[model samples]
Target: MAALEPERAKLDTTIPNESRIADYFLGGKDNFAADRAAAEHALTIAPELPALSREGRRFLRRAVRFLAGEAGIRQFVDIGCGLPTQGNVHEIAHSVAPDARVVYVDHDPMTVVHGQALLQDNERTVVIEADARDPAALLTHPGLTSVIDLDRPVAILLFAVLHCVPDDDLATHIVTHLRKAIAPGSYLALSHPVSDLCPEKTAKLAAVYQAQGTITGGRRGNLRTKAEVERFFDGLDLVEPGVVYTPLWRPGEETPHRPDATWVVGGVGRKPRRPREHPALT
Candidate 1:
């Protein structure tokens, strides 16, 4: 708790924090009055906000399982990881592979504090306070590299986070920068709310969220079109059924109804391995 004083000092309970609002949407009690009010206001615009939140979590679970189970990846770096909730990255990854190592990064001070407290006893996971827009700093942070090796094949999760980067150029830079750092065969999994599903409705919803502000300084929410979201995976090999609606990504069975309500597209892409060098003939 001594570490919480500084983190708490940096917080403003009056302005709704994006992570806390997300927690409220997921039926968590860690939010303040401002967070609740903002979430309620957003619900008036899009009544399906809560459901979309749940669907997002489902996509995250499925994606994590695929990475730690099928892809055989043991290292994970989950950036912009919001408040801890059920089926967290480490919990899901550890279920498949007990040896899996995970590092959760978030810019929110409270989120980092809470995550640190919750994960204190868990040796396999650690949380650090870092901005997603600055990929270099967060990627190279001693706290992050300590848990997961950047040189190895690591799975980077960006679930419901990038839209916070209002600047398209910065978003592109963040993803491309990260892609360059990871070794060949590393994976990137992301889910983003898209404007392609219902442009007018999403636009209004975006307006509502903008009014309340976000964690990424003064920049408002930027809901990208499905095509724009897919561009984040450039230079990587997309897994099967690339960048589809959240529930449709790999639902297997028990598919959720009206997946379009989620208004989000998700996909997993792997960095292709380098071709072996040719031997010099004698």
Candidate 2:
């Protein structure tokens, strides 16, 4: 694989980025004290955040395995892919399908740089510095174009990233555009932070992220109701046991049950060969 070098010198270590902070929560050594402090503050507001992160990660692994092994998905476009952690999308996907191709997209310089470094020897993977809000940019990137065949079935991974998108319409637009770009049989695996699970505590953490100059901006984290999340997949065919808590989304092993308000919701939907046209699309 050719090296896709990023301008790493431009990385700003002063500010706490979502990717690095997430790395902190995952118990990785790539984060700084500032990131750790912000993560700790976030925990103060929502004590189960670390656990939520773990569950979310687990959900991602399970989803990717299903997509590659069971769903016969060979291509993956992971948007808002944070810093490379254990059981990353590419690793899990390739484990089942050795030929599976993955394109990771994120605007964070650190994530792009580190991901590129980690994926250097993997010709089947590519990392592009692109924001999830701009699906066009991501779709048109050389790296994405090189790895993902848009006209074929692909799994679009939006795991734990929609919270960064505050504009409801833009969030919808991003998914709509990407869905249009892919052929039928494509899949969308999404996991988002939900305030309904722990409204007060989640809101408090949202405030901390806002104060930390993080991209989340205290913008309510777009913590949607379960029905609203279902709205995002209006035209797609939802998989079995649809739109449940992250741990409950096809939990392979028996997971310890938490309170009803667990702060995260996840689901996978398949783009039918003939999906109903939505009024919103017109």
Candidate 3:
């Protein structure tokens, strides 16, 4: 709670927040006026923008189900987890394994507040208010320590958050650091908004977000290409059908196929267990 105080102090209604805007698009009531205005502006440019959000949430849920049921991952660190809504990470994970532990990380004060409130009664989950770029801080947070085991296989969920990280180098560094820091069997799941799908629409929507001062720290949205999105999985072994469009990645019967204009890509990868070196000949 003390650690989140700094993030709480940074909360302001004037600056629209990416998480809140996402919540708005997801049809959650956790967003404020600024976030609604930004989402409304984005809809004017792309009326199907809300579909993108829903698709992203579906990806997250499916990924969790796969990890918990198939991969046997009981611990999850959901970075940049936006406002908690129905079918949250914990709920999806625990649905498969009741003992699942989830640590949610986000820098938005309202997100932290809402997350804490929503998870207060859940003993196996916690919300840590911190920047996603600082994986060290997030991993070392007291809340995470209380809920997760760093040495055990865990799933790091970065759903719909990578585009908020503007700096390519910084984003790569963050993923690289987490890859090495967590256990060898750990997994990374990510979804990013790609600009190549509809360049003009992407630019227009980005401009609207920027003009609203959508406080994703300093970046607006940095959409990427499919190839560019693959870079985040450099050191990890991608799962089957790797790095495909969000709806196309292991689509379930209920997953709806979207047009190229949706532009979001997602994937899940595992950090391979490094081979041990043999002793020198005596």
Candidate 4:
């Protein structure tokens, strides 16, 4: 049988897309041959890639639920949102708050195209093609503001996406930029792969991604330690159980176990109502 066309989206199926690779990791069938190859290549080194990806998704679900239900947030902006799959940010948020609005942003054209098609009928949500590195542009997009009100408390989600920004300075700038742009009481929830638990494995995994391309796109490893990853949340007030292993962040029912099981670390930070000058969350 021949390979099927990428629906109507003009996607370069030849090159491995980060979203497609993540889709493959999440056991989805929307990936191309290139994505499977890249994923298989990484699997040889880190067999836990799939598990790590699923754990990261779990963290996203938990965080979004918290923001919508417990945190009383009504607007959500999910940057670097990959392929639209089950239990997306909008779905999770809507479950808790029917009136909650969500804006899903992804630089990948394929993701944007596919998400737009999938969400065309969902009035409360909209997906836009935008780069996460430029938070100001995306945050200010009419498409985002159409659904999200930046004036009030909105949750900005960066789940399993920041590691793609290998440049330390640029990564910090992105977070800081977003922190500055959002109004007071807004929240930033992020989950990043950490190297503190398994330095050797994580480094090799980073090299695998670094070899693949400029953006080491993966949620399992990025060669940064817990401390380094924590810098992204600087200045903002971290919520309870700040920056811990994914499973330990807010695990349901079951007792959280080994940190190595979930090498990825996650946390949710909020901007105070009266910042002593509105510092950047660098």
CA RMSD of each candidate after superposition: 5.6, 4.6, 4.7, 5.6
Q: Where does candidate 4 clash, by residue pair?
A: none
The residue-level lDDT of candidate 1 at 212 comes to 67
Quick one: best lDDT, which candidate? 1
Candidate 3: list runs displaced more than 4 Å. 1-9, 215-222, 275-282
lDDT of 1 by residue, 1-282 (tens): 011122432678887887898899999999999989888988887889888888989999999999999999999999888999999999999999999999999888899999999999998899998877678888989998788888889999999888776567778778888888888888999999998877888787777776666535234444789999998887788899998999898897757747857699999999878712312100
How accurate locally, in lDDT, is each candidate? 0.83, 0.79, 0.81, 0.82
TM-score of 1: 0.91
Cα RMSD for candidate 4?
5.6
How do all the candidates rank in terms of lDDT, highest first?
Answer: 1, 4, 3, 2
**Superposed model 4: Cα runs more than 4 Å off:** 1-10, 214-222, 254-258
**lDDT tens digits, residue span 1-282, model 2:** 112223422467776778888888888889877788888887776777777788888889889999998899999999889999988998899889999999998888888999999999999999988866667877998888888888899999999887766556777788788777778899999998876765666666666776676653125543666677777776778897788877788877757346275668889989888756854323
Q: Give Cα distance to truth, residue 192, candidate 3, Å.
A: 0.4
Q: Write the per-residue lDDT of candidate 3 for residues 235-278, one digit (tens) a residue.
A: 77889889988888888787466746558999999887771231
Candidate 4 C-alpha lDDT tens digits along 1-282: 112122322467877777889999998988888889999988998898888888788889889999999999999999889998878999999999999998999887889988999999999999997777666788888999888878888898999888877667667778888887778899999998878777887788787776765253223345778898888787789999999998988888745646667789999999888765645632
lDDT pick, better of 1 and 4:
1
- The C-alpha stretches of model 2 lying farther than 4 A from their native spots are 1-10, 216-218, 254-261, 280-282
Please report, as a residue range, the 10-residue window in candidate 3 with the lowest summed lDDT.
Answer: 273-282
